[model samples]
Target: MKDSFAQLDLTTEGFRLLFEATWIQRPAGLTATATAGEWRAVRTPDELAAWALAWSDGDEDEAALFRPELLADPATTVVAGHDPDGRVLGGAVLSESGTVTGVSNLFAAGDTDPAQVWSGCLGLIASDRPVVGYESGDDLTAALAAGFQETGPLRVWLDA
Candidate 1:
């Protein structure tokens, strides 16, 4: 089944924050304003290693996999969100173009608001394409909230 989803646009203030950031001091190598999660300037191999460790969650000694030069590149984009306790719950990285090239976690498909927010942000960069993606579940209310139309007659199936 196919459904259309709502697109959200940032408020003027949010747009300002999204577009006008200069620098973010990150624990992992320094990132440009375009990149969301980068915290500091990564100048050395040690710094790059530390930054990689800080960004990852589990026991994966994969920091060495990173190219040191990429850590400081401004063209890279990172985005992150924190829980109430200030721990990261979600994040992603994108090239200058808005593509879901990498994601930390799959989106909570039921949460239309967050999905709308993402679409809104995407609208800013990729205006030609439909900013929203597809989501599937038993819950149609969530889809409605995201501006989706019910594709067929609602039916409930039960085990006999």
Candidate 2:
């Protein structure tokens, strides 16, 4: 389970901390740097499948996590960034809530600057509401560079 606020203690319940990350938030109307790739929403199942492949780096087992039903949800948008030749280079999943848009599953191809992916994603979303997400290590750095601020700590737990 995900402890978004890092306020829960579950050790006694047989849950162990799996990992920790920082919650990031980008205020409304902030612009990210432009990237050479183009970003667009995944409107079709085929596009979402392709995006899943790219996001999972061709790992079929991992790709199966993103079901096609997500596309039918008006509040969820699967975005893909492609190169000039139409090769999906990066992507993200945006889930809109009442007051904020949550970004998740952000990924990029080999050697691609994550900042580019974040920039392209922000451009494609173009939402007036704030964008929120979580990350660790290099990804967190990239998000920070893309105008996101560290809001708080988060933790993931695994049942033992």
Candidate 3:
């Protein structure tokens, strides 16, 4: 489970610390230029399925995580970056809350830079509210380079 505030001590409950990440935020109204790939919101179920496939690297079980019902959510948007040949190179899911948009499920494929995906996602969102998310490792580096600032720490635990 996600311990967003890093306040949970799950060890006694039989959970183990899986990983730690940082909360990241980008200021509101920041503009990003389009990158090499074309970015747009996925509108159809077919498109969403395709995006999920790309995101999971063709792993059907993993792709199933993103259901078609997500597309109907008013606050949720699935954005995909496509190359000239129409292949999905990267994507992200944007969910808007009260004052900030949450960016998640960000992924990049062959020859696609994670920074470019973040930029394209920001351009597609184009919202006045700040963007917030969490990341670790290389993704954290990419988000930082794409103009996000570290906000706080977060942790994930697994029932072991």
Candidate 4:
């Protein structure tokens, strides 16, 4: 159900298909100038694949699990940052602990303090598992600032 985008290769058409098929519109506040603070949840595999590639550097397993079809039973929380025109600049999704997770792709400018954004994302996940796959810079800094610590040694899998 994870939309199969990662199963093959990522492309604009594939992304579009995934987005159109899996994206769910929700009420979220957004702004221009690359400040996408508003959030809408994703519920389809294709949407999850697109988001994962864009945000997590094409993490296949992470993206695959987020497929809307697979998350049908649980809450696959999708949050988006949009430009004034409502194009997605970045986003994040919350999955059950063992499901999909990655760094926060906020669209705030460099001057914007990452700690603040970290707090915002933390606020979204109440009574959930520890967030995983953060981008490992400001994102990780923000997570630490917001009271999340590493649960184990860092690990990554690559194709041989």
Candidate 5:
């Protein structure tokens, strides 16, 4: 079954402060067994494909987030995580309220920290709206660390 997920929501401006105040100051080792990484917006189909491929192991549901219909939307914004070697690590997506960062994001895969991923992903999203998404564990921690307070828990049942 799918695990129950927690939603992390906050204003873009609020999150940016977290990014600038805490997240960006952290170290980024992502090379030669380093402890840093980087993120960039996925502007092309190939870029989106690479990002999605890294996150979609065998789950069609996960891959469906990369559908062309989703990608074609101007609101859609996918960000890629890569190590110094340029290997595709993972990705995050933002889109919903035309000005918020709420859609989808798979920020784990490589050695990058969830906070860093969240911070970087926000770089491309519109800053005028609020951000929201379902996350857990380190990702959840990252969101909270970014200054988001819990509204409530989100139960998500998986097909077993």
Candidate 6:
């Protein structure tokens, strides 16, 4: 079940194993310290614009998809990291607060590690709930190191 990457048959047992493998966790004692690792909005119009751009892969049209109301929703957590002095390092969007979360827009300052940023974000919301996301390349690596497991993959089609 654990090493079924090659034996993935999607059988009942395979599905069960796949389900069990997908998860996220904060390393022991590796969570936030008050406001240092807090989850909040981007804090400025410019920052929000940048975050939206990153979330949309530099597509300004897709960036426009995120409205202020949606970004500030009580349920959606679109957050950026800050030092004690409060500098905007990076941020992410963790959605579906009530159930399994989907992570996105994982960007951070070069000085900070994206995986660690994700860990702190997940700690704020993970709370023993499962977190899911579409990841590839380095993002996929970061996800795995952040305690996520490979369940499968994803695809998206543009209708416009």
Best of the candidates, TM-score:
3
RMSD of 6: 8.0
Cα TM-score of candidate 3: 0.94
Per-residue C-alpha lDDT of model 2 across residues 1-160, encoded as one tens digit per residue: 9998999999999999999999999999886677878788999888988999999999988999988999999999999888999999898999989988999999987677898899999987665789999999999999999999999999999999
TM-score of each: 0.31, 0.93, 0.94, 0.45, 0.63, 0.60
What lDDT does each candidate get? 0.34, 0.91, 0.91, 0.45, 0.56, 0.60
Which residue runs of candidate 6 sit more than 4 Å off their true CA positions? 1-65
lDDT of 4 at 13: 34
The deviation in Å at residue 140 for candidate 5 is 0.9
Task: Tell how far residue 40 is off in model 6, in angstroms.
Answer: 3.8
Model 6 C-alpha lDDT per residue in residues 11-89, reported as the tens digit of each score: 5432432222222333333333333354565655677776677555578998897777765666677777666756655
lDDT of 6: 0.60
Span of 10 residues, lowest total lDDT, candidate 2: 29-38
Given candidate 1, what's the lDDT at residue 19? 19
Clashing pairs in 5: 1-158, 2-158, 28-35, 28-36, 29-34, 29-35, 29-36, 30-36
Candidate with maximal lDDT: 3
Better-scoring candidate (lDDT), 2 or 5: 2
After superposition, which runs of candidate 5 have C-alpha atoms over 4 Å from their true positions? 1-38, 57-65, 158-160
By summed lDDT, which 10 consecutive residues of candidate 4 come out lowest? Answer: 19-28
Better of 1 and 2 by lDDT: 2
The C-alpha RMSD in Å for every predicted model, in order, reads 16.5, 1.4, 1.3, 12.8, 11.0, 8.0
Off by over 4 Å in 2: none
